[model samples]
Target: MARKLPSRTTSDDTKSARTRERILDSTAAVLSRKGYSETRLTDVAEEAELQSPAIYYYFKSREELIEEVMWAGIAHMREHVEGVLAALPPETSAMDRILAAAEAHLRFSLSVSSYTTAAIRNSGQMPERIRERHEAERAKYGRVWRKLFKDAADDGELRDGVDLLTVRMLVIGSLNWAAEWWTPRTSKIDNVVEQARQLISNGIAK
Candidate 1:
Protein backbone atom coordinates (compact mmCIF):
# COMPACT_ATOMS: atom_id res chain seq x y z
CA MET A 1 0.00 0.00 0.00
CA ALA A 2 1.10 3.57 -0.74
CA ARG A 3 1.77 5.84 2.25
CA LYS A 4 -0.26 9.05 2.78
CA LEU A 5 1.59 12.37 2.57
CA PRO A 6 1.21 15.08 5.15
CA SER A 7 -0.65 18.32 4.33
CA ARG A 8 0.38 21.90 5.26
CA THR A 9 -2.28 24.00 7.00
CA THR A 10 -2.48 27.71 6.01
CA SER A 11 -1.03 29.06 9.27
CA ASP A 12 1.74 26.49 9.27
CA ASP A 13 2.67 27.36 5.70
CA THR A 14 2.77 31.07 6.53
CA LYS A 15 5.01 30.50 9.53
CA SER A 16 7.22 28.23 7.47
CA ALA A 17 7.61 30.90 4.81
CA ARG A 18 8.53 33.52 7.42
CA THR A 19 11.18 31.24 8.87
CA ARG A 20 12.59 30.57 5.43
CA GLU A 21 12.80 34.26 4.68
CA ARG A 22 14.63 34.91 7.94
CA ILE A 23 17.17 32.25 7.10
CA LEU A 24 17.61 33.58 3.58
CA ASP A 25 18.10 37.13 4.84
CA SER A 26 20.65 35.93 7.37
CA THR A 27 22.42 33.96 4.66
CA ALA A 28 22.64 37.08 2.51
CA ALA A 29 24.28 38.93 5.40
CA VAL A 30 26.82 36.18 5.92
CA LEU A 31 27.60 35.93 2.20
CA SER A 32 28.12 39.66 1.97
CA ARG A 33 30.52 39.70 4.90
CA LYS A 34 32.41 36.52 4.07
CA GLY A 35 31.81 36.14 0.30
CA TYR A 36 31.05 32.85 -1.43
CA SER A 37 34.54 31.45 -0.86
CA GLU A 38 34.41 31.62 2.95
CA THR A 39 30.72 31.54 3.89
CA ARG A 40 29.58 28.52 5.96
CA LEU A 41 26.19 27.03 6.69
CA THR A 42 26.76 27.09 10.45
CA ASP A 43 27.49 30.80 10.26
CA VAL A 44 24.20 31.32 8.49
CA ALA A 45 22.39 29.21 11.07
CA GLU A 46 23.87 31.26 13.87
CA GLU A 47 22.83 34.44 12.12
CA ALA A 48 19.31 33.08 11.81
CA GLU A 49 19.16 32.01 15.48
CA LEU A 50 18.56 28.42 14.48
CA GLN A 51 20.43 25.15 14.89
CA SER A 52 22.51 24.09 11.92
CA PRO A 53 20.37 21.02 11.37
CA ALA A 54 17.24 23.11 11.32
CA ILE A 55 18.51 24.89 8.23
CA TYR A 56 18.33 21.71 6.20
CA TYR A 57 14.66 21.52 7.00
CA TYR A 58 14.27 24.54 4.75
CA PHE A 59 17.20 24.29 2.31
CA LYS A 60 18.65 20.99 1.27
CA SER A 61 22.21 22.30 0.94
CA ARG A 62 24.41 25.34 1.08
CA GLU A 63 24.25 25.69 -2.68
CA GLU A 64 20.47 25.70 -2.69
CA LEU A 65 20.30 28.32 0.06
CA ILE A 66 22.81 30.48 -1.77
CA GLU A 67 20.74 30.23 -4.93
CA GLU A 68 17.64 31.37 -3.06
CA VAL A 69 19.46 34.35 -1.55
CA MET A 70 20.91 35.28 -4.92
CA TRP A 71 17.49 35.20 -6.57
CA ALA A 72 16.01 37.38 -3.84
CA GLY A 73 18.75 39.93 -4.28
CA ILE A 74 18.30 39.96 -8.05
CA ALA A 75 14.56 40.45 -7.65
CA HIS A 76 15.09 43.40 -5.33
CA MET A 77 17.54 44.98 -7.77
CA ARG A 78 15.20 44.46 -10.73
CA GLU A 79 12.29 46.15 -8.97
CA HIS A 80 14.38 49.14 -7.90
CA VAL A 81 15.88 49.67 -11.33
CA GLU A 82 12.58 49.20 -13.20
CA GLY A 83 10.84 51.60 -10.83
CA VAL A 84 13.48 54.31 -11.31
CA LEU A 85 13.47 53.96 -15.07
CA ALA A 86 9.69 54.07 -15.18
CA ALA A 87 9.68 57.39 -13.30
CA LEU A 88 11.97 59.19 -15.75
CA PRO A 89 10.40 62.14 -17.60
CA PRO A 90 9.53 61.43 -21.21
CA GLU A 91 11.38 64.48 -22.49
CA THR A 92 14.57 63.93 -20.49
CA SER A 93 17.70 63.79 -22.61
CA ALA A 94 18.85 60.20 -23.02
CA MET A 95 22.38 61.02 -21.79
CA ASP A 96 21.20 62.82 -18.66
CA ARG A 97 18.59 60.19 -17.91
CA ILE A 98 21.17 57.46 -18.32
CA LEU A 99 23.43 59.17 -15.81
CA ALA A 100 20.54 59.48 -13.38
CA ALA A 101 19.79 55.81 -13.82
CA ALA A 102 23.41 54.93 -13.13
CA GLU A 103 23.38 57.00 -9.97
CA ALA A 104 20.21 55.31 -8.79
CA HIS A 105 21.64 51.86 -9.51
CA LEU A 106 24.82 52.59 -7.60
CA ARG A 107 22.91 54.03 -4.66
CA PHE A 108 20.70 50.97 -4.38
CA SER A 109 23.59 48.54 -4.79
CA LEU A 110 25.70 50.24 -2.16
CA SER A 111 22.80 50.56 0.25
CA VAL A 112 22.11 46.85 0.06
CA SER A 113 25.71 45.72 -0.02
CA SER A 114 25.14 42.08 0.88
CA TYR A 115 22.39 41.46 -1.59
CA THR A 116 24.24 43.15 -4.42
CA THR A 117 27.44 41.29 -3.73
CA ALA A 118 25.66 37.95 -3.49
CA ALA A 119 23.69 38.56 -6.66
CA ILE A 120 26.78 39.48 -8.68
CA ARG A 121 29.16 36.80 -7.45
CA ASN A 122 26.72 33.89 -7.42
CA SER A 123 25.04 34.67 -10.71
CA GLY A 124 26.87 31.96 -12.60
CA GLN A 125 25.91 29.31 -10.07
CA MET A 126 22.19 29.98 -10.14
CA PRO A 127 19.82 27.24 -11.25
CA GLU A 128 18.28 27.44 -14.74
CA ARG A 129 14.94 28.70 -13.43
CA ILE A 130 16.61 31.35 -11.30
CA ARG A 131 18.89 32.29 -14.17
CA GLU A 132 15.90 32.80 -16.46
CA ARG A 133 14.25 35.05 -13.88
CA HIS A 134 17.36 37.19 -13.57
CA GLU A 135 17.95 37.17 -17.31
CA ALA A 136 14.45 38.50 -17.99
CA GLU A 137 15.01 41.41 -15.61
CA ARG A 138 18.47 42.03 -16.98
CA ALA A 139 17.07 42.09 -20.52
CA LYS A 140 14.73 44.87 -19.45
CA TYR A 141 17.70 46.78 -18.06
CA GLY A 142 19.53 46.14 -21.32
CA ARG A 143 16.70 47.72 -23.27
CA VAL A 144 17.15 50.95 -21.34
CA TRP A 145 20.87 50.96 -21.99
CA ARG A 146 20.34 50.19 -25.67
CA LYS A 147 17.88 53.03 -26.03
CA LEU A 148 20.21 55.47 -24.30
CA PHE A 149 23.21 54.48 -26.38
CA LYS A 150 21.30 54.43 -29.63
CA ASP A 151 19.66 57.77 -28.97
CA ALA A 152 22.96 59.34 -27.97
CA ALA A 153 24.53 58.10 -31.18
CA ASP A 154 21.63 59.25 -33.29
CA ASP A 155 21.62 62.69 -31.65
CA GLY A 156 25.34 63.22 -32.37
CA GLU A 157 26.15 62.98 -28.65
CA LEU A 158 28.45 59.97 -28.93
CA ARG A 159 31.55 59.89 -31.12
CA ASP A 160 31.18 58.57 -34.66
CA GLY A 161 32.33 54.93 -35.11
CA VAL A 162 31.98 54.19 -31.37
CA ASP A 163 30.87 50.64 -30.59
CA LEU A 164 27.78 51.01 -28.42
CA LEU A 165 28.04 47.50 -27.01
CA THR A 166 31.60 48.04 -25.86
CA VAL A 167 30.71 51.36 -24.26
CA ARG A 168 27.65 49.95 -22.54
CA MET A 169 29.53 46.98 -21.06
CA LEU A 170 32.41 49.10 -19.82
CA VAL A 171 30.18 51.69 -18.16
CA ILE A 172 27.85 49.16 -16.53
CA GLY A 173 30.54 46.62 -15.62
CA SER A 174 32.54 49.22 -13.70
CA LEU A 175 29.51 50.39 -11.77
CA ASN A 176 28.35 46.88 -10.87
CA TRP A 177 31.83 45.96 -9.68
CA ALA A 178 31.71 48.81 -7.12
CA ALA A 179 30.00 46.61 -4.51
CA GLU A 180 33.27 44.74 -3.96
CA TRP A 181 35.06 47.44 -1.91
CA TRP A 182 32.38 50.01 -1.10
CA THR A 183 32.47 50.92 2.59
CA PRO A 184 30.33 53.23 4.72
CA ARG A 185 33.27 55.18 6.17
CA THR A 186 35.33 55.99 3.10
CA SER A 187 33.34 55.26 -0.05
CA LYS A 188 32.01 58.48 -1.57
CA ILE A 189 29.28 57.06 -3.80
CA ASP A 190 28.03 60.35 -5.21
CA ASN A 191 31.51 61.36 -6.28
CA VAL A 192 32.14 57.95 -7.76
CA VAL A 193 28.86 58.11 -9.61
CA GLU A 194 29.72 61.50 -11.12
CA GLN A 195 33.15 60.24 -12.06
CA ALA A 196 31.60 57.23 -13.78
CA ARG A 197 29.24 59.51 -15.67
CA GLN A 198 32.10 61.73 -16.77
CA LEU A 199 34.18 58.75 -17.78
CA ILE A 200 31.51 57.40 -20.09
CA SER A 201 30.56 60.79 -21.49
CA ASN A 202 34.14 61.83 -22.16
CA GLY A 203 35.09 58.52 -23.73
CA ILE A 204 32.28 58.58 -26.24
CA ALA A 205 31.47 62.30 -26.54
CA LYS A 206 31.34 63.61 -30.07
Candidate 2:
Protein backbone atom coordinates (compact mmCIF):
# COMPACT_ATOMS: atom_id res chain seq x y z
CA MET A 1 0.00 0.00 0.00
CA ALA A 2 1.13 3.52 -0.80
CA ARG A 3 1.91 5.83 2.12
CA LYS A 4 -0.90 8.24 2.92
CA LEU A 5 -0.25 12.00 2.94
CA PRO A 6 -0.86 13.96 6.11
CA SER A 7 -3.91 16.21 6.24
CA ARG A 8 -4.67 19.60 7.81
CA THR A 9 -8.10 20.88 8.84
CA THR A 10 -9.37 24.46 8.65
CA SER A 11 -8.92 24.89 12.40
CA ASP A 12 -5.37 23.60 12.21
CA ASP A 13 -4.51 26.03 9.42
CA THR A 14 -6.12 28.92 11.30
CA LYS A 15 -4.15 28.13 14.41
CA SER A 16 -0.95 27.93 12.40
CA ALA A 17 -1.65 31.33 10.83
CA ARG A 18 -2.33 32.85 14.25
CA THR A 19 0.87 31.43 15.63
CA ARG A 20 2.84 32.87 12.74
CA GLU A 21 1.31 36.29 13.29
CA ARG A 22 2.16 36.11 16.99
CA ILE A 23 5.73 35.29 16.14
CA LEU A 24 5.95 38.25 13.79
CA ASP A 25 4.46 40.56 16.39
CA SER A 26 6.91 39.38 19.00
CA THR A 27 9.75 39.81 16.51
CA ALA A 28 8.77 43.44 15.98
CA ALA A 29 8.57 44.08 19.70
CA VAL A 30 11.96 42.56 20.39
CA LEU A 31 13.55 44.37 17.46
CA SER A 32 12.15 47.69 18.60
CA ARG A 33 13.61 47.18 22.09
CA LYS A 34 16.77 45.15 21.60
CA GLY A 35 17.57 46.02 18.00
CA TYR A 36 18.95 43.65 15.36
CA SER A 37 22.35 42.77 16.79
CA GLU A 38 21.14 42.23 20.33
CA THR A 39 17.98 40.39 19.26
CA ARG A 40 18.18 36.64 18.88
CA LEU A 41 15.80 33.84 17.97
CA THR A 42 15.65 32.90 21.63
CA ASP A 43 14.49 36.38 22.54
CA VAL A 44 11.77 36.28 19.92
CA ALA A 45 10.73 32.82 20.96
CA GLU A 46 10.54 33.85 24.61
CA GLU A 47 8.51 36.88 23.63
CA ALA A 48 6.21 34.68 21.58
CA GLU A 49 6.07 32.16 24.43
CA LEU A 50 7.19 29.32 22.21
CA GLN A 51 10.32 27.20 22.05
CA SER A 52 13.11 28.80 20.04
CA PRO A 53 13.03 26.06 17.40
CA ALA A 54 9.35 26.74 16.76
CA ILE A 55 10.28 30.02 15.11
CA TYR A 56 11.88 28.01 12.34
CA TYR A 57 8.41 26.89 11.33
CA TYR A 58 7.72 30.47 10.32
CA PHE A 59 11.18 31.81 9.41
CA LYS A 60 14.49 30.25 8.42
CA SER A 61 16.68 32.65 10.37
CA ARG A 62 16.73 35.81 12.48
CA GLU A 63 17.45 38.00 9.46
CA GLU A 64 14.50 36.58 7.55
CA LEU A 65 12.20 37.21 10.50
CA ILE A 66 13.36 40.82 10.81
CA GLU A 67 13.01 41.36 7.07
CA GLU A 68 9.44 40.12 7.15
CA VAL A 69 8.64 42.43 10.05
CA MET A 70 10.02 45.43 8.16
CA TRP A 71 8.13 44.45 5.01
CA ALA A 72 4.90 44.19 6.98
CA GLY A 73 5.38 47.73 8.30
CA ILE A 74 6.03 49.07 4.79
CA ALA A 75 2.97 47.30 3.44
CA HIS A 76 0.75 48.69 6.19
CA MET A 77 2.06 52.22 5.67
CA ARG A 78 1.49 52.04 1.90
CA GLU A 79 -2.06 50.81 2.34
CA HIS A 80 -2.80 53.59 4.83
CA VAL A 81 -1.42 56.32 2.55
CA GLU A 82 -3.32 54.96 -0.45
CA GLY A 83 -6.56 54.76 1.49
CA VAL A 84 -6.19 58.32 2.80
CA LEU A 85 -5.54 59.66 -0.69
CA ALA A 86 -8.43 57.71 -2.19
CA ALA A 87 -10.88 59.01 0.41
CA LEU A 88 -10.30 62.67 -0.37
CA PRO A 89 -13.24 64.52 -1.98
CA PRO A 90 -12.99 64.86 -5.74
CA GLU A 91 -13.08 68.65 -5.42
CA THR A 92 -10.25 68.85 -2.89
CA SER A 93 -7.25 70.95 -3.95
CA ALA A 94 -3.89 69.35 -4.65
CA MET A 95 -2.30 71.12 -1.69
CA ASP A 96 -5.10 69.92 0.58
CA ARG A 97 -4.59 66.38 -0.62
CA ILE A 98 -0.85 66.63 0.04
CA LEU A 99 -1.47 67.91 3.54
CA ALA A 100 -3.96 65.15 4.19
CA ALA A 101 -1.43 62.57 3.07
CA ALA A 102 1.20 64.11 5.35
CA GLU A 103 -1.18 63.98 8.28
CA ALA A 104 -1.98 60.34 7.66
CA HIS A 105 1.69 59.40 7.36
CA LEU A 106 2.58 61.17 10.58
CA ARG A 107 -0.34 59.67 12.46
CA PHE A 108 0.44 56.13 11.43
CA SER A 109 4.13 56.53 12.24
CA LEU A 110 3.22 57.66 15.72
CA SER A 111 0.71 54.92 16.39
CA VAL A 112 1.22 52.05 18.86
CA SER A 113 2.92 49.89 16.27
CA SER A 114 6.70 50.07 16.51
CA TYR A 115 7.40 48.17 13.30
CA THR A 116 7.96 51.30 11.24
CA THR A 117 10.01 52.98 13.95
CA ALA A 118 12.21 49.93 14.38
CA ALA A 119 12.67 49.54 10.64
CA ILE A 120 13.62 53.16 10.18
CA ARG A 121 16.07 53.14 13.10
CA ASN A 122 17.73 49.80 12.41
CA SER A 123 17.76 49.48 8.62
CA GLY A 124 21.40 50.52 8.48
CA GLN A 125 22.35 47.55 10.66
CA MET A 126 20.62 44.95 8.53
CA PRO A 127 22.76 42.57 6.49
CA GLU A 128 23.62 43.64 2.97
CA ARG A 129 21.14 41.36 1.23
CA ILE A 130 18.32 42.11 3.64
CA ARG A 131 19.04 45.84 3.45
CA GLU A 132 18.83 45.71 -0.36
CA ARG A 133 15.50 43.93 -0.18
CA HIS A 134 14.11 46.43 2.31
CA GLU A 135 15.38 49.33 0.18
CA ALA A 136 13.55 47.90 -2.83
CA GLU A 137 10.30 48.01 -0.88
CA ARG A 138 11.09 51.57 0.28
CA ALA A 139 11.71 52.65 -3.31
CA LYS A 140 8.27 51.45 -4.29
CA TYR A 141 6.81 53.32 -1.32
CA GLY A 142 8.57 56.54 -2.47
CA ARG A 143 6.86 56.40 -5.86
CA VAL A 144 3.49 57.07 -4.22
CA TRP A 145 4.72 60.36 -2.78
CA ARG A 146 6.42 61.20 -6.05
CA LYS A 147 3.16 60.85 -7.96
CA LEU A 148 1.29 62.99 -5.41
CA PHE A 149 3.84 65.80 -5.72
CA LYS A 150 4.06 65.45 -9.49
CA ASP A 151 0.31 65.77 -9.81
CA ALA A 152 0.31 68.88 -7.64
CA ALA A 153 3.12 70.45 -9.66
CA ASP A 154 1.42 69.61 -12.95
CA ASP A 155 -1.82 71.18 -11.73
CA GLY A 156 0.06 74.44 -11.08
CA GLU A 157 -0.56 74.25 -7.34
CA LEU A 158 3.14 74.26 -6.54
CA ARG A 159 5.34 77.35 -6.83
CA ASP A 160 7.23 77.90 -10.06
CA GLY A 161 10.69 76.27 -10.48
CA VAL A 162 10.21 73.93 -7.50
CA ASP A 163 12.13 70.65 -7.65
CA LEU A 164 9.48 68.01 -6.95
CA LEU A 165 12.03 65.31 -6.02
CA THR A 166 13.81 67.49 -3.47
CA VAL A 167 10.51 68.64 -1.99
CA ARG A 168 9.35 65.04 -1.63
CA MET A 169 12.62 64.02 0.03
CA LEU A 170 12.56 66.88 2.51
CA VAL A 171 8.94 66.27 3.45
CA ILE A 172 9.43 62.53 3.84
CA GLY A 173 12.74 62.92 5.66
CA SER A 174 11.10 65.22 8.22
CA LEU A 175 8.27 62.77 8.82
CA ASN A 176 10.60 59.79 9.14
CA TRP A 177 12.81 61.62 11.58
CA ALA A 178 9.86 61.97 13.93
CA ALA A 179 10.45 58.35 14.89
CA GLU A 180 13.46 59.61 16.83
CA TRP A 181 12.04 62.51 18.87
CA TRP A 182 8.23 62.69 18.74
CA THR A 183 6.34 61.91 21.96
CA PRO A 184 2.65 62.20 22.65
CA ARG A 185 3.21 63.73 26.10
CA THR A 186 5.37 66.57 24.78
CA SER A 187 3.84 67.19 21.30
CA LYS A 188 0.48 66.24 19.90
CA ILE A 189 0.18 64.47 16.56
CA ASP A 190 -2.31 67.07 15.34
CA ASN A 191 0.06 69.91 16.23
CA VAL A 192 2.93 68.23 14.41
CA VAL A 193 0.72 67.59 11.40
CA GLU A 194 -0.37 71.22 11.20
CA GLN A 195 3.22 72.43 11.52
CA ALA A 196 4.35 70.13 8.72
CA ARG A 197 1.39 71.16 6.60
CA GLN A 198 2.16 74.85 7.06
CA LEU A 199 5.82 74.32 6.24
CA ILE A 200 5.19 72.36 3.06
CA SER A 201 2.26 74.44 1.89
CA ASN A 202 4.08 77.73 2.49
CA GLY A 203 7.12 76.59 0.54
CA ILE A 204 5.33 75.08 -2.44
CA ALA A 205 1.88 76.64 -2.63
CA LYS A 206 1.50 78.88 -5.65
Candidate 3:
Protein backbone atom coordinates (compact mmCIF):
# COMPACT_ATOMS: atom_id res chain seq x y z
CA MET A 1 0.00 0.00 0.00
CA ALA A 2 1.09 3.57 -0.67
CA ARG A 3 1.81 5.88 2.23
CA LYS A 4 -0.79 8.58 2.87
CA LEU A 5 -0.38 12.06 4.18
CA PRO A 6 -2.57 14.11 6.53
CA SER A 7 -5.02 16.42 4.84
CA ARG A 8 -4.56 20.19 4.99
CA THR A 9 -8.22 20.44 5.91
CA THR A 10 -7.60 18.23 8.96
CA SER A 11 -4.83 20.56 10.17
CA ASP A 12 -7.03 23.59 9.70
CA ASP A 13 -9.86 21.88 11.55
CA THR A 14 -7.61 21.10 14.51
CA LYS A 15 -6.44 24.69 14.71
CA SER A 16 -10.00 25.92 14.54
CA ALA A 17 -11.01 23.59 17.34
CA ARG A 18 -8.20 24.89 19.52
CA THR A 19 -9.16 28.47 18.83
CA ARG A 20 -12.75 27.74 19.77
CA GLU A 21 -11.65 26.14 23.06
CA ARG A 22 -9.42 29.12 23.80
CA ILE A 23 -12.35 31.44 23.33
CA LEU A 24 -14.53 29.38 25.66
CA ASP A 25 -11.78 29.23 28.29
CA SER A 26 -11.19 32.96 28.14
CA THR A 27 -14.90 33.57 28.45
CA ALA A 28 -15.08 31.35 31.53
CA ALA A 29 -12.25 33.19 33.25
CA VAL A 30 -13.75 36.55 32.35
CA LEU A 31 -17.12 35.43 33.65
CA SER A 32 -15.45 34.46 36.93
CA ARG A 33 -13.93 37.93 37.28
CA LYS A 34 -16.28 40.41 35.59
CA GLY A 35 -19.52 38.42 35.71
CA TYR A 36 -22.29 38.16 33.11
CA SER A 37 -23.40 41.79 33.07
CA GLU A 38 -19.91 43.20 32.51
CA THR A 39 -18.30 40.65 30.20
CA ARG A 40 -17.65 41.94 26.68
CA LEU A 41 -16.33 40.23 23.58
CA THR A 42 -13.34 42.54 23.64
CA ASP A 43 -12.56 41.42 27.16
CA VAL A 44 -12.53 37.80 26.11
CA ALA A 45 -10.53 38.58 22.99
CA GLU A 46 -7.88 40.21 25.09
CA GLU A 47 -7.87 37.33 27.51
CA ALA A 48 -7.47 34.85 24.67
CA GLU A 49 -4.85 37.10 23.04
CA LEU A 50 -6.81 37.02 19.81
CA GLN A 51 -8.04 39.91 17.74
CA SER A 52 -11.52 41.05 18.81
CA PRO A 53 -13.07 39.87 15.56
CA ALA A 54 -11.64 36.40 15.99
CA ILE A 55 -14.09 35.72 18.80
CA TYR A 56 -17.06 36.07 16.49
CA TYR A 57 -15.58 33.38 14.29
CA TYR A 58 -16.18 30.99 17.15
CA PHE A 59 -19.21 32.61 18.82
CA LYS A 60 -21.87 34.71 17.16
CA SER A 61 -22.29 37.26 19.93
CA ARG A 62 -21.68 38.06 23.59
CA GLU A 63 -24.80 36.18 24.56
CA GLU A 64 -23.74 33.10 22.64
CA LEU A 65 -20.28 33.09 24.20
CA ILE A 66 -21.66 33.57 27.68
CA GLU A 67 -24.14 30.81 27.13
CA GLU A 68 -21.40 28.42 26.10
CA VAL A 69 -19.25 29.45 29.06
CA MET A 70 -22.15 28.98 31.43
CA TRP A 71 -22.90 25.61 29.92
CA ALA A 72 -19.26 24.52 30.09
CA GLY A 73 -19.10 25.57 33.72
CA ILE A 74 -21.71 23.24 35.14
CA ALA A 75 -21.36 20.55 32.49
CA HIS A 76 -17.63 20.11 33.01
CA MET A 77 -17.92 20.03 36.79
CA ARG A 78 -20.70 17.49 36.71
CA GLU A 79 -18.82 15.30 34.26
CA HIS A 80 -15.63 15.55 36.24
CA VAL A 81 -17.18 14.84 39.61
CA GLU A 82 -19.20 11.94 38.29
CA GLY A 83 -16.13 10.56 36.61
CA VAL A 84 -14.37 10.70 39.97
CA LEU A 85 -17.17 8.84 41.63
CA ALA A 86 -17.38 6.30 38.86
CA ALA A 87 -13.73 5.42 39.24
CA LEU A 88 -14.13 4.11 42.76
CA PRO A 89 -13.99 0.37 43.36
CA PRO A 90 -17.35 -1.35 43.14
CA GLU A 91 -17.11 -2.40 46.75
CA THR A 92 -16.34 1.07 47.99
CA SER A 93 -18.66 2.28 50.71
CA ALA A 94 -21.32 4.82 49.84
CA MET A 95 -20.04 7.28 52.41
CA ASP A 96 -16.55 7.05 50.99
CA ARG A 97 -17.90 7.70 47.51
CA ILE A 98 -19.79 10.66 48.85
CA LEU A 99 -16.68 12.06 50.54
CA ALA A 100 -14.68 11.65 47.35
CA ALA A 101 -17.38 13.50 45.49
CA ALA A 102 -17.39 16.31 47.99
CA GLU A 103 -13.66 16.71 47.61
CA ALA A 104 -13.96 16.62 43.87
CA HIS A 105 -16.66 19.28 43.92
CA LEU A 106 -14.68 21.52 46.24
CA ARG A 107 -11.46 21.18 44.28
CA PHE A 108 -13.15 21.81 40.96
CA SER A 109 -15.00 24.82 42.25
CA LEU A 110 -12.02 26.33 44.01
CA SER A 111 -9.07 25.59 41.73
CA VAL A 112 -9.50 23.02 38.98
CA SER A 113 -11.39 25.20 36.50
CA SER A 114 -12.52 28.80 36.39
CA TYR A 115 -15.53 27.41 34.55
CA THR A 116 -17.09 25.95 37.69
CA THR A 117 -16.18 29.00 39.71
CA ALA A 118 -17.97 31.12 37.14
CA ALA A 119 -20.97 28.83 37.35
CA ILE A 120 -21.07 29.02 41.13
CA ARG A 121 -20.53 32.78 41.10
CA ASN A 122 -23.28 33.58 38.63
CA SER A 123 -25.85 30.89 39.31
CA GLY A 124 -28.80 33.27 39.31
CA GLN A 125 -27.71 36.16 37.10
CA MET A 126 -27.80 34.43 33.73
CA PRO A 127 -30.55 35.67 31.43
CA GLU A 128 -33.75 33.70 31.60
CA ARG A 129 -33.26 32.14 28.19
CA ILE A 130 -29.72 31.06 28.94
CA ARG A 131 -30.78 29.82 32.35
CA GLU A 132 -33.53 27.78 30.76
CA ARG A 133 -31.09 26.35 28.27
CA HIS A 134 -28.50 25.31 30.87
CA GLU A 135 -30.95 24.37 33.56
CA ALA A 136 -30.70 20.71 32.62
CA GLU A 137 -26.97 20.71 33.25
CA ARG A 138 -27.41 22.18 36.74
CA ALA A 139 -30.09 19.64 37.43
CA LYS A 140 -27.87 16.83 36.28
CA TYR A 141 -25.26 17.85 38.82
CA GLY A 142 -27.97 18.03 41.44
CA ARG A 143 -29.01 14.50 40.61
CA VAL A 144 -25.45 13.27 41.14
CA TRP A 145 -25.46 14.60 44.69
CA ARG A 146 -28.96 13.38 45.22
CA LYS A 147 -28.05 9.84 44.23
CA LEU A 148 -25.02 9.88 46.49
CA PHE A 149 -27.21 10.93 49.37
CA LYS A 150 -29.77 8.29 48.55
CA ASP A 151 -27.05 5.66 48.46
CA ALA A 152 -25.78 6.73 51.84
CA ALA A 153 -29.25 6.42 53.31
CA ASP A 154 -29.76 3.00 51.75
CA ASP A 155 -26.40 1.79 53.02
CA GLY A 156 -27.13 2.85 56.58
CA GLU A 157 -24.36 5.48 56.52
CA LEU A 158 -26.70 8.36 57.18
CA ARG A 159 -27.86 9.02 60.71
CA ASP A 160 -31.34 7.79 61.55
CA GLY A 161 -34.02 10.37 60.88
CA VAL A 162 -31.63 12.49 58.81
CA ASP A 163 -33.32 14.26 55.94
CA LEU A 164 -31.46 13.61 52.76
CA LEU A 165 -32.73 16.75 51.05
CA THR A 166 -31.73 19.10 53.82
CA VAL A 167 -28.30 17.53 54.28
CA ARG A 168 -27.78 17.54 50.55
CA MET A 169 -28.57 21.22 50.53
CA LEU A 170 -26.11 21.88 53.34
CA VAL A 171 -23.29 19.87 51.77
CA ILE A 172 -23.67 21.05 48.18
CA GLY A 173 -24.38 24.62 49.20
CA SER A 174 -21.29 24.77 51.41
CA LEU A 175 -19.07 23.26 48.70
CA ASN A 176 -20.34 25.76 46.15
CA TRP A 177 -19.85 28.62 48.56
CA ALA A 178 -16.14 27.80 48.83
CA ALA A 179 -15.64 29.02 45.27
CA GLU A 180 -16.45 32.52 46.41
CA TRP A 181 -13.82 32.93 49.13
CA TRP A 182 -11.16 30.20 48.93
CA THR A 183 -7.65 31.28 48.06
CA PRO A 184 -4.12 29.94 48.37
CA ARG A 185 -3.30 32.90 50.56
CA THR A 186 -6.10 32.04 52.92
CA SER A 187 -5.50 28.28 53.26
CA LYS A 188 -3.95 25.37 51.50
CA ILE A 189 -6.41 23.85 49.07
CA ASP A 190 -5.75 20.44 50.61
CA ASN A 191 -6.57 21.76 54.05
CA VAL A 192 -9.79 23.19 52.79
CA VAL A 193 -10.63 19.93 51.05
CA GLU A 194 -9.87 17.95 54.17
CA GLN A 195 -12.03 20.22 56.30
CA ALA A 196 -14.88 19.97 53.83
CA ARG A 197 -14.59 16.19 53.72
CA GLN A 198 -14.76 16.08 57.51
CA LEU A 199 -17.86 18.27 57.57
CA ILE A 200 -19.69 16.13 55.03
CA SER A 201 -18.66 12.90 56.74
CA ASN A 202 -19.53 14.11 60.22
CA GLY A 203 -22.84 15.60 59.14
CA ILE A 204 -23.99 12.30 57.70
CA ALA A 205 -22.11 9.77 59.82
CA LYS A 206 -24.48 7.33 61.52
TM-score of each: 0.80, 0.90, 0.95
Residue-wise C-alpha lDDT for candidate 3, range 1-206, written one tens digit per residue: 98899899999999999999998899899999998889888899999999999887877788888888788889999999999998999999999999999898888888889988988898789878778657889999899999998998998998988998998998888988888888889999999999988887787787
Q: Compare candidates 1 and 3 on lDDT and give the better one.
A: 3
What stretches of model 2 exceed 4 Å from their correct place? 1-8
Pick the winner on TM-score between candidates 1 and 2.
2
lDDT string, candidate 2, 1-206, tens digits? 99966666877999999999999999888887888899999888999999999999889888899999887777778788889999988998888888888888888878756778777768778888887667887888898898889889889999999998888999999988887788888788888888988998898898
lDDT of model number 3: 0.89
Which 10 successive residues of model 2 have the least lDDT summed? Answer: 112-121
RMSD of each: 6.1, 3.9, 1.4
Over the stretch 1-206, how does candidate 1's per-residue lDDT look in tens digits?
A: 99866666877999999999889989998987877767899999999999999999998888778877776676677677768877988887777767777887788888754676677766665657546656765676678778878888887787888898998888888878887767777658778778877887787776
TM-score preference between candidates 2 and 3, better one: 3
What ranking emerges by lDDT with the best candidate at the front? 3, 2, 1
Kindly report which residue stretches of model 1 are placed more than 4 angstroms away from their true locations once superposed: 1-14, 124-140
Q: State in Å the error of residue 130, model 1.
A: 8.0
